[model samples]
Each structure stands twice: as C-alpha cells, then as structure tokens.
Target: MSTLRVRPSTVLFAILAVGGVAFGTTCVEACLGPGRAAVRLARTARLAERLQLTDLCLFTEARYTRHASQADRHAAFQDHPAALEHFPSGSLMPPSGAANRASP
Candidate 1:
C-alpha cells in the first residue's frame, strides 16, 4: 500500500483559508443585518439630500449673480424649491452690494 503524504505548508494554507472565510462571513453577517442595512441606507440618503441642497444653493447664487439675468434666476429658483424653503432668507444670496460689482 502506498503511503499518502500531506505537506505541512499545504495543510497550513488550507487552515488559513478556511479561517479567513469564516471570519469574513461572520463580520458581514453581524454588520449588515437587514435592519442595520436599512438604517444605514436611510442615513446615507439624508446626507445626500443635504449635500445636494448645498450644491443647488451655491449654483443658484452663482448663476443669479454672474449673468444678472432674471430668466436664469427664475429657472434656478424653480429647480429646487425644497432647498429654498430650507434655508433662511438671504442666506444663499451674495452679501449686500457684492453682486453688483463688475469684475475687471
């Protein structure tokens, strides 16, 4: 009968691979339970909305000032009414007299 030979390095590698997979599986299961995942999604969506609001405000301010055109201002205002409602009055507008200065 021929003897079966198992190399030490091969056995060690198999054990490490199995252990790593198990550890990864456990971590994923614990971190991303259905409820936990949903909460994380909700938080991410809210953060995205806040960031989008900031971007819209900045863009509207730039368009309103640079062009000094009422059509562009109206178009930008119509784009994000919800963001406009969120901020206090004059928060997004340039400081008094700032927009009127012509760039050299």
Candidate 2:
C-alpha cells in the first residue's frame, strides 16, 4: 500500500480556516455582549415602570397588624385570668395595648 502525504498548503489552509472561525466568533460575541446587556436592562426598567412596588403590603405592616390584633384579643381575655397566665410577659405575645398604637 502507498503511504499518504498531506500537502503543506492544504494544512496551512485548514489551520487558517480554524483560526478565522475562532476570531470571527470572538468578534461577534464582543459586538453583541453590550447590546444583549442593554436589552436586559430595558426589559427590567419596563417591568419596574409597570409594577408599583410601594403599594404592595409590607411584611412589617402585616406582622404588626397580626400581632397587634392578637394582643388586643389577649387584653380582652383579661376577664378569663387563666388565659393571660398561659402567655408569660416578653414571650411571643406583644404588649397588651399595642393594638391601639399608630402604624409605623
């Protein structure tokens, strides 16, 4: 069987083709990176503009309302002296009069 020999020009052409592809890919990525980032930023800005973050019920507000009303209920249960005894002072229960206080 005869041995096969690869020509220098053919090898050079193959190497150049691979190098050109790599360089072209890098150039395309660099060109599109900033454009992609700007698109994402614009989408985020549009979503923010459409949604009202401030109007949503705050965690603290919900917690305050829940605990304050609980305290008021506990206060009302004062007639049942045994009920107040179940929850010790400084425990999970808020202060008895917190329900009437102004919202922060």
Candidate with top lDDT is 2
Runs in model 2 deviating more than 4 A are 39-104
Report the backbone clash tally of model 1.
0
Local accuracy of candidate 2 as per-residue lDDT tens digits, 1-104: 99999999999999999999999999999999889899897887677678833222312323333344444544535658564443333344455354556764
lDDT of 1 by residue, 18-69 (tens): 9999999999998878777898878877987877632223333344533333
Candidate 1: 10-residue stretch with minimal lDDT: 66-75
lDDT of each: 0.56, 0.59
Report how far off residue 95 is in candidate 1 (Å). 45
- In model 1, residue pairs whose N, Cα or C atoms come closer than 3 Å (at least 3 residues apart or on different chains), thus clashing, are none
Per-prediction TM-score to the true structure, in the order listed: 0.30, 0.36
Clash numbers, per candidate: 0, 0
Query: Residue 22 CA error for candidate 1 (Å)?
Result: 1.0
Sliding window of 10 residues with minimal summed lDDT for model 2? 53-62
